[model samples]
Target: SRHAQFAKPHSLWLNDPDSEQDTDEDDSDEVEQIDQDEIFDLIRSISDPEHRSMTLEQLAVVSAPQITFNSKVPDRVTVEFTPTVPHCGMSTFIGLSIRVRLLRSLPERYKIDIRVKPGSHESEHALNKQLNDKERVAAALENPALLEVLEQCLSTAGRST
Candidate 1:
């Protein structure tokens, strides 16, 4: 039986050597720092919850240009995503998917900040709040139904390019 529901989306691919990118951090022993393209690639293939056949990249919900990290604060990353519609009810789930993807793929030291693009969602502030709140995010994932759906959305992220 495939108990993917409890699995992290990036778990399967994390050990794949081909999936690893060479980073130019301070030293070889230093933790690898990922760039915008790497971040985009990690999430570009995430399957949209509603359009199962389409990816977040294909749906234009997430893009490399929308991902950023300040040079001085390389440990902090901010990803702004746009909902397909201002009233899209799945904004929170979409944000969750991004958060979970980054959380699983990036180094533990990386501070991932997932948010909705300004004016992109009617509840943008609330969405950002939920996504950034560790407690709320944990609570959301604790819900079996949401976790199952999240697993489904993330399962397709390992597609070979």
Candidate 2:
């Protein structure tokens, strides 16, 4: 009975065997659903310069990031981004933020290429490299004593002025 059920084409659908009625209507929704593994994969590709154990997604800088696969370039991913604001000075910061995120999420077998669409902020390609440097900057800023040192320096400079 199991074999017959699987073998019979018409058994699954009683009416309109070849019609579209048997098809699922929510293809777009299905396509939009990113698997848990894929989400983790994408998340690991990012690193936040501002905080340890925090990501761009965690920082709420990234909106919906769409990933598409290509048969020709199985090892390459093209990423597109949208910034929070049109004229924010941090567009470069955010773009770099996303670029770093992608690089960290993917494995060595896969290469990531980032492209920020026109009409969004930060059109330059230089931001990609800048993102890689965020970790260093973030680490420097993380030192609790750095603020006190800076304040003392500022006070000394102010007195000299």
Candidate 3:
């Protein structure tokens, strides 16, 4: 129910004995190929920040077509989401919830690229930069307050619509 413990667990990934074997099995022997539908299934049910009862899918903020897998690269997945309005303020939380869900579900080798659907938000560029940058993402995860809220949003990952 609460898989948020692994949100930014770099050290745990490295040090956990159980995870090391899991990682080896997941990382080397074979590559896990994911499709748009599978990726969508992973994130589509995330709880919307503004509406507790609505999933991102229910709100039409995200869809399977908005996700793309890089067949050429194989390890990169890009996900785009349209906010409720051009200037919707819950963009970061929604983006973070998507990223966190993927990070928790996907193998370590996959590089997730998350962004606001182009032109869907007034500050699309800035929001995209903050969401994609490793530094900013790590910084955000460090805040206890934000993490609590993010955990709440992500807590409904698969249990909802």
Candidate 4:
């Protein structure tokens, strides 16, 4: 069931020894580095709660270039996103969605910083603080109403992908 959630149709393995099909060599022993595109891929498909037909990518909320990872600070990633409108009431909701997406998709060691792009929202600092606050985020996820909305938005991510 887990595999079905994120699987592509193509198979990577080659059964016939004589076939010239080549598989990329495994480098699992090396440190797994996360990059901007990988982070973007993880959250880009999330649905906008107010706009069910559109994805966060389509609304220009999540951009690959806005995501960054520092190799020097392993297991940490920063993602700054813009709300569709400067005063969009859903800014906090969007931030929460991104936070939840990364928390579920990335490994336990990863420390995610989800923030509103500077000057994009009127309450950028406050929203960023709320989103990054472990206790606040946890509490928000526990609310049945917010959780329902989050689940609805997240459900579309899998189908759209």
C-alpha lDDT of all candidate models, in order: 0.73, 0.39, 0.71, 0.71
Whichever of 1 and 3 has more TM-score, that candidate is 1
User: For residues 1-161, could you state the per-residue lDDT of candidate 3 as single tens digits?
Assistant: 12224334542111111111111111112336677887787788787766767899999999999988787986798999998888676676678778877877787888999988888989899888878888867876776656666666666776635
Model 2: worst 10 consecutive residues (lDDT sum): 12-21
Q: Model 2 segments beyond 4 Å from truth?
A: 1-41, 44-65, 122-161
TM-score list, all predictions: 0.79, 0.41, 0.78, 0.77
* Runs in model 1 lying further than 4 Å from the true structure: 1-31
Candidate 2 lDDT over residue span 82-156, tens digit each: 544444444443443344334433455655555555556543454444433546435533443432322221221
Cα lDDT for residue 109, model 4?
Answer: 88
Relative to the unseen true structure, what is the C-alpha lDDT of residue 120 in candidate 3, on a scale of 0 to 100?
90
Pairs that clash in candidate 1: none
Provide the global lDDT of candidate 2 against the true structure: 0.39
- Model 3 regions more than 4 Å off: 1-31
lDDT, candidate 1, residue 85?
89
What is the alpha-carbon RMSD of candidate 4 to the true structure?
14.1
Model 4, global lDDT: 0.71
